[model samples]
Each structure stands twice: as structure tokens, then as C-alpha cells.
Target chain A: MYNKIGPIFKKEFSSYFNSSIAYVFIVLFIFIPNLMFFYFFGGIFKEEMATMRRFFQMMPYVFIIFIPGLTMGSWAKEKNEGTIEMLFTFPISQWKVIAGKFFAAWALVGIAVGSTLFIPILTQLTMGDFDWGQIFTQYVGAMLMAATYIAITFFMSSLTMELIDSFLLSSSILLLLTLCGYITSAYVMIFPDWLGWLKVILNEISLSTHFNNFSKGVIHTKDVVYYLGLAMLFFYFNMKSLESRKWS
Target chain B: MISVKNLVKSYGHGKPAVKGVTFTIGKGEIVGLLGPNGAGKSTIMKIITGFLNPSEGEVLVDGLNTIDNPIEIKSKIGYLPEKSPMYQDMIVYEYLKFISEIRGISNEKADDAIQSMIKLVALEKVASKRISELSNGYKKRVGLASAMIHDPEILILDEPTAGLDPNQIIMFRKILRKLSEKKTIILSTHVLSEIEAMCEKVIIINNGEKVADNSIQELMKTYDKEQFIDFVVEGESLLSIEDEISQIKGAWKIEFEKKEGKNQFRFKALISEGSDFEKNLKSNSNNWKLVSSEIKKANLEEIFLKLTSQGEDNV
Candidate 1:
């Protein structure tokens, strides 16, 4: 299993690095958030906050588009180019292949997220105050959020052979999850008291609702479980999609 | 070494792509998978490769079940899909190097493997070129190189020579033959000549089912009774000749076609075994002159059409 996944990871990583697409996305992932922070929120470094509130806050939206782009071609491109058939003939577990691809994409997102740490480090050097705990919490939160999104995108990609369809499907789901809380709150305001339970269910499904607490410098166990569980759920679904394609 | 048992794969609960494919490819055997379009050839190949799970049966590679120990089974096999699956941006050497590394070869071994495979496939001229820049035939060579770079025991190739020039196809076949000395090869192609020339064993598939699985020699023997003799005749009108030829004893079937302006008729006479049909044609000289008459052996093309088309009707 390790041997199989190791090659898969290497192939996927090289595929990302050799293509200009990865560099383009890396630039957008890092530059756009900081640029927006500088133009709207005043330079992040000037604020002296170890917790990257601006960066972490913008990631949910950034990843809404970026994660789908990164994962849209994962299984979809393999299927499209007929490589998936090649991959299956090898003596490797289906889950290992899925994990190999998932972690490789996650690692790229990890590197992209890690690059923005320079901004926080610059703030710590110039400004006197730095909350190490809060920064760590926010970084963990960002990683978890990215992991969940990557899993979702990978699952969506596995279900379709078309890159555009994978992208649209993943983005649409992300959009719905991103807006779930707001949509539910608006419904609750107009609905009866008994129907307020719908808001609780909607909030539970909203990724941002759980991520927001972690971004605020508190590492809640429930939030950690939520993120990890969501990631695993999507990963499992991705494997099943691949397995189902063989018979279907 | 691979064993597939009663494998069935259906697309969306419709007609099964592979209804019940069962075969065993022993170690060092080069098997040719022959079929026409939509014959579930690719699907069966996929199932054996562990890419697509079998809906109703099991596949075992080297005694390891594909479903239970896919990784171990995969490590023993290398596969090239019909379209030459590859990363277009990476250089040929770099791509092979990556595959070598992923297959868990050491740096030194990876280097040696890559070097040998590049030489084996004659990719040295364009080793540094990006895969996207290579020609279709070259890309196929690269795909074959990747499949062999790891030195796996089994190689599964789908349509390995689909889009190559005649010269390239010959070279590719030579390379495959060389590799088969050390590895088992399952080659799928619609072309019958590929099987007759390269394969020791043949499996004919149609509509996702195995119609015939036997040695090439055995398949020929099965149809030996239906032997055909082709005769090119000069100075003969085909219309007048048909009745005289049909009346001959032991002539089970007769088909004739005329050549323009030449007064020549090509006759295909089907005869039973032990019949002196050639002597009978020679004796009838005044009615029709036998320009040339020889027994034509059944080639893979005829065998494939006979098996698949007739096999489908039986099913």
C-alpha cells in the first residue's frame, strides 16, 4: 500500500509542479488574500496580530474557488486521459490511491498556506504583541478547513470524467455550504418558534460556523472533530466513486 | 501469472460490458486479446488490472487476490491504457524517473532502469523532450517504457499499436516480444495480424464476453473442416461457370466474383476434408481454365470475424 501510494503521490506532485497551473494558483492563493488585506484591512503586519484573522477569514472564500481548481482534475483528468484504467491494473488498494492523491493535494495546499506565514512573522517582528496560541489555533483551523475542502473537491472529481463538471459541482457544493448559515438565519427570523431547529441543523452543516470559532483563537474539540469527520466522509465517498465506476 | 473467474461488469444495470470472462495467463505466456469495437476488451483489461472491480467474481495475480491485496498485485504488473496515459508536461526521462522512484526503486537502480528503458524503447533521441512535444508513436513508446521501467512481471497493454505507422508498429512489436521473454503480456488489439504474428495464445471477446480462448493453432483446427480454396480463372464467364462448379461432388459452397475486362473469375470453393477438389478442377480444363488454385489458410481476421459475429448470433 505504501509503495502504491508513494508513486501516486510522486506522480501527482510532479504533475502539479511541472504544470504552470500550480504556480498560477499558488500565486493567487497567497497574493490575492494579502493584497486584499493591505488594500482593505490596512497592512496585516501593521496590525501586530499573530492570529492571521484577515488571511484566515479570506481563506474560506479563497478556498471556495482554489480548492476546486486544485482537485478538479484529480480523478477526472485520469479518467479523461484513460490513465485511471492504467492505475487500476496496478496492484494497489483503491483507498491508498485515493489517499495518495488527497494528501498530495493537501500538501500543496499546506505549502501554499505555509507561505503566508511570512506575513504573520513580519507582523511579529515589527509589532511588539504576538499571541502564539492564537496564531497556532488559526493555522490549525486553516489546515483543517483546507483539508475538508480538498476532500470534497477530490470526491467531486472522482464522480465525473469532465474537469469542468467536477469544478462546477465542487464549487456549487462549497457555495451552498458557505451560504448555509446566512440562509438559515434569514429563514429563522421569518419562521415559527418550532421550526428554529432547522437553523441548528443548518449551522451544523455550515463549515464556516465551525471554522469561525477556531479562527478566533480557540481550538474547540467539537470543531476539530467536525472538520476531521467531514474530511474523512468526503475521502470515503471519493474511494466509493472510484470503486463504483469499475462496475458502472 | 493471472487468473480471472466469472468476471462480470455492467454499466448502469444495462447490458453487462463483461458478462462472464474467465481465463488464466500463466507466467511467461504472451496472450493476445482480440475483439472488434465495443467488445468489452478494455473493460476486461481494466478489471484484471484492478482499475475496475469485478461485479460478480475475483481476479488473482500471482496467487494474490486483486480485491484483497491490490497493492501487492499492482506492484507485480504494469499497464498501458489505450490512449497512452501520461503527464504531458514532464520530460520523458523525468517522467520515467518519477515512475521508477514511485515504484520504490533506489536512486541507482532508478537511474539504471530509466537508462535501459530509454534505450529499450529507442527514446534516447528525445529523452529530454517534454511528452507533449513527442509524436503519437513516440508517446506510445514512452508509455511502454513506463510500463516496463519498473521491471514488473506482467504487462497489460490496451490497443498498444492503435495509431502507429507500419514501421513503428513493427518496432513496437519487437520490443514487446523482447519484454515478453521476462514478463507475461496481455495485448489487446482489433487487428488480427497482430495476434497471428506476436501472440502465442489468443482470446476472442465480443460484447463483453469471452467467445473463444485457445492457442492459435487450436482455433485454426476447430475450423479446419470449413477450408476454402481460392481459384483465379482466365477465359471464363462467371455466370456460366457457377452451375458447373456447384454440381461438382464435395463442393459444399461456392462464391465467385468477376474481374473487369479480363475475363477472370475468382472462385472460393468450400470443400470437405479428404476431397480431391484440386484434381477435379484440373481435369475440367475446357469448361474453365484453372489459372491458379491454392488452399488459403484461415488467418486471424477470418477467425475473429467468424468467432465474434457468429458467436454473437449464438449468444
Candidate 2:
């Protein structure tokens, strides 16, 4: 199984490194978030700074767009060119193929996330005081968020052969997850106590609520479970989508 | 060896793409799967390769069921699909190397196999070129090299020469023939001439069912024992001449077509055993002039059309 998966990882990684698309995505993911933080929230560098709160605040929005763009073509291109049929004819299992592609895309996002560490390092150099625990916690939160988004986008890519369709479907799902908190809060404010069950379910499904806890340097087991559960859910669906093509 | 029993595959609950298709290819035989377009040749190939599961029935390769032991079966087979599916962004050497590693080949052997396959397929000239830059023929050669890189015992090729020039077609056929010496080959093509040139046995499918499966010689024998003779004659209203020829003692069936101008007609007559066709044409008293006459042998094309087309007389 490792032998079968190793080649897929190497091929995908080489594709990401050789193409300019990876560079473009890395630049946008790192520079845009920092640029936004510096331009809008200049108080992050103030003498009475408490934590890297502003940086983590900007990650959800940054990842909402960046993750979809990075993963929109993970499996769509293979299906479009009929290479998936050739790959399936090999001795490798379907689960290994899916796991290999998912891990490769996650690793690419990990590189992009790693590049942003320079910003925090710069702040620690220029400023005497910085919250190390908060910064570490926020990095963990960003990794989890990106992993979940990558899984969702990879699943959407497997569901369609058209790249544009994959992009649209991924972005729409990300947008919904990002806005779930606001939608749930509004429902609680307008509805009466009789229909309060709707608000309870909405809050449980909201990813932002769990991300907020992690962003604030709080390592709750429930939050970890939430992100891991979502990731597994999407990955399972991705495998199922691939298997369904054989019968259809 | 490969064996398929009552293989049935359907798409979206509609009519079956391959219905009750059953055939077997021995370890050293090179069999050709001949069929027209949409005749379920690819579907059968897909099932045998373990790329698609059959809706009903079983496929056994080398004594292992395709569904129960797909990975083991897949490792024993190499396949080249109809479209020549390839990663266009990969260089020729890189793509073959990736396939080698994926198939669990060690580094030293992978290197040696890649070298041999590149030489075998004559891809040494453009080994470093990306697949997109190569011509269609070169891309197809790369696909073939990838399929053979692992040294599998069986090869399934679908329309392997679909997009090649006449010279490339000849070269491709030569490559397949050479490869068949060491591997069982199941070559599928709609071109009847290629089947005639390469395959010892031919299996034809029509409307998703096996219509005929036999050697080329056996298929020819099923039509009729009467031999057909084509002659060029100078005459009008050859119908009367055909009627007259049909009335002869040994002439079974006679037909004629006018060859435009010069008052020439192309005539064909089926003659029974011990009948001298040349002698009978010469002994005729009519004003018909016999230019030339020869025994016509039925090629695969005629047999293919006769088996596939509806409402056509058997002879």
C-alpha cells in the first residue's frame, strides 16, 4: 500500500512544484493575510500587545478562498483527461489513491501555512513581547481549518469532471461554513423559545464556533473532534464518489 | 490464461453494454476483439482489467477471480485504453518511471526496465520531451511503453492504432506481434485488415453480444462451399445472362453489375463442385466476351459486415 501511494504523492508533489500555480497560491495565501493585518489592524504591534489575536482573526477569511483555489483540480483533471480510468486499472486500491491525493494536497496547504510563520517571527524580532502560546494555538487552528477545507474541496473535485464546477461547489460550501455562525445567531435572536431546537442544531454544526475556541488558545477535546470528524466525513464521501463511477 | 463466464454489464439500468459475453484467451495466444463502434468491446476490456465490475458474472485471470482478488489479477495484466490516457504534463521518462515505481519495482530494476522499454518503443529520441509536445503517434508509443514497463504477462489494448499513419500502423502491428511472443495479447480494433494480419483467432461482437468466435479459416468456411468467380464481360442487360447462367447445371447463384461505359459488365457466379467455371464461360454461344475470371476468397471485412449487418443474405 505504501509503495502504491508513494508514486502518487511524488507525482502530485512534482506537479505542484513545477507549475506556477502553486507559487501564485502560496504568495496570495501568505502576503494577502499579512497585508490585510498590517493595513487594517496596526495595533497588533503596539507596546501593550497581548496576543497575535488579529492574525488569527484574518485566517478564516483568508482560508475561505485560498483553500478552494488550491484544491479545485485535485481529482477533476484526472477524470477530465480519462487518466482516472488508467489509474484504476492498476493494482492499487481506491482508498489508497484517495488518501494519497488528499495527503498531498494537505501537505501543499501545510507549506503555505508554514510560510506565514515568518510574519510572527518578524513580530517577535521587532517587538520585545509576544504570546507564544496564543500563536502556537492559532497555527494549530489554521492547520485544522485548512485540512477540513481541503477534504471538502477534494470530495467536490471527485464528484465532477469540470474544474469550474468543482471550484464553484467548493467555494459555496466554504462560504456556507464561514457564515454559519452569523446565521445561527440571527435565528436565535428572531425565533421564540418553542423553536429553540433549530438554534441548538445550528450552533452544533457551525465550524466557526469550534474554530473560535482554538483561536483563543483553548485546546478543547470537543473542538478537535469536530474538525477531525468533518475531515473524515468528507474523505469518506470522496472515496464513495470514486467507487460510484465504476458502476455508473 | 483468462476466462470470462456470462459477463453482463449494464449502464444506468438501461440496456446492457455487454450482455452474456463469454470467451477465453490462452496464455500464449494473441486474440483480436473485432467489433463496430459501440459494440461493448471496451466494456469487456474494462471488466477483464478490473477497472469496472460486471453487473453479473465472473472473470478469472490466471485462476484468480477479478472481483475477489483484483489487485493480484491487476498486477498480472497491463492495459492500454482506447483513448491512450496519459498525463500530458509529464515527460516521457518521468511518466514511465512513475508507473514503474507504482507497480512496486526496485530502483535498479526500474531504471533498467525504463531503459529497455524506451529502447523497445523507440522513444529514446524524445525521452525528455513532455507528452504534450510529442505527436499523437509518439504519445501512443509512450502509453504502450508505460503499459509494458512492469513486464506483465497479459496485455489488453483497445484500438491501439486508432490515430496512426499507415507506416505507424504497420510499426505498431509489428510491435504487438513481437510482444505477443512473451505475453498473451487481447487486441481490439474495428479495422478488419489489422485483425487479418495479426490475430490467429477472431471474436466479433455486435449489439453487445458475442456474434462469432472462431479462427479466421473456420469463419470463412461457414458461408458456403460454392466458390465465387468474378469476370469482366462486354454486354448490356446482364440480368438475362445471369438468368441464363443460373439455369446451367452447376451454376448455383449468378449476379452481375455494369462497369459504366465500354459496354462492360462485372459478373459473379457461384459454381458447384467439379464445375470448370472458365470452361463454361468460354463455351457460351452468346456475344458475351469473358475478359478475366478468378476464384474470389472471402476476407475478414466481408465476414464482419455479413455478421454485423441485418437483412443480409448469408452467402
Best by TM-score: 2
DockQ of 1: 0.49
- Where does model 1 exceed 4 Å of error? A1-4, A41-55, A122-127, A184-188, B229-300, B311-315
Every candidate's DockQ is 0.49, 0.63
With a 3 Å backbone cut-off (N, CA, C), the pairs that clash in candidate 2 are none
Residue B312 in model 1: lDDT:
27
How many residue pairs of model 2 clash at the backbone?
0
lDDT for model 1 comes to 0.82
- Candidate achieving the largest DockQ: 2
What tens digits encode model 1's per-residue C-alpha lDDT throughout A1-248?
56668878877886898887779888988889888887777756566445577667777888899999999999899888877766676545678888888889989998988888887778778764777788888888999999999999998898888999999999999989977865776666755678778778888999788888777889889999999999999988988887777656
Number of clashing residue pairs in every model? 11, 0
Once superposed on the true structure, which residue ranges of model 2 sit more than 4 Å away at CA?
A41-50, A186-188, B224-297, B311-315
